[model samples]
Target: MHVYSRRKRKAGVSDRGARVGKIERTTYALGWRIHTVATQGGLPLTYRVRQANVNDEIPTLKLLIEAVRLLHRAGLSIKLLIADAQYYWKDFFKLSRWLGIKPVIPARPQIKKTLINLRVKHGFIVEGDPELIRQYHRG
Candidate 1:
């Protein structure tokens, strides 16, 4: 699940239950955050909507599990998962590994640096080849 925001700029909008949240410094919006799970082909599989103030990670595990179950029933296998930095957490990584899915998310900057340093100290490859990394990012 990845989170995306939509602006609700109209005043006195009714019944949509949009909430006001700060999206950046000196900017605020009334809207919802969309959590979407999509295929590598850019086809949307499932989605959930929640208030903008809600955290993206909250629904991620549940969404992944749901997608896995649905795919399994249809005889499909989940081979790789590509997501943005917002989904880069240790638990998320563990979950994907446990499910036999290769997670292709770039870690947050500090985490990335730490990981690279550790890899160098342990004599492991710091990063994949540029072409392979680029392909994953494109997805």
Candidate 2:
């Protein structure tokens, strides 16, 4: 399962669960953020609703843990996990690796630069195998 965010804007203060927060630079809204975990085919596996101020990563780990547990109980296994760069924190990668899920996320800019530099310092080819490089670049 993978998580994605949806912005739900409220029209009035009577919208009990929504909160006011910046959605983007210089823009603010009263809303709830819907974080959902879904199958690769687009079926929702589970979801969480939180005030708009909540960051995606905060609930993502919890959502993944729950999804993994549910899948395990059904005798299923997750092969790969695909998520946006927002979910590219090192701890998340480590946890997914520990759980045997191949993460298919593109590194954030700073991390990408660090990885490139590390590869160069280690004398490893930056784009060694054409096909493998292609797949990595796909994310």
Segments of candidate 2 deviating more than 4 angstroms = 1-12, 24-26, 112-139
Candidate 2 lDDT by residue in tens digits, 1-139: 2222334456333556567766665977777777887888778787898888788878888888888988999999777776655676778878788889877665544454431111211332333335434544553
State the lDDT of candidate 1 residue by residue for 1-139, as single tens digits: 2234454367644445677755664876767767778888878777788887777778888888888888899999789887765587788878888889887775554564432112211332335456546645578
Q: What TM-score goes with each of the models?
A: 0.73, 0.69
Flag clash pairs in model 1: none
Specify the highest-lDDT model's number: 1
RMSD of each: 6.0, 6.8
Against the correct fold, how does model 1 do in TM-score?
A: 0.73
Clash pairs, candidate 2, are: none
Which 10 consecutive residues of model 1 have the lowest summed lDDT?
A: 115-124
* lDDT score at residue 89, model 2, on the 0-100 scale: 74
Query: Model 1, which residues run further than 4 Å from truth?
Result: 1-16, 22-26, 112-132
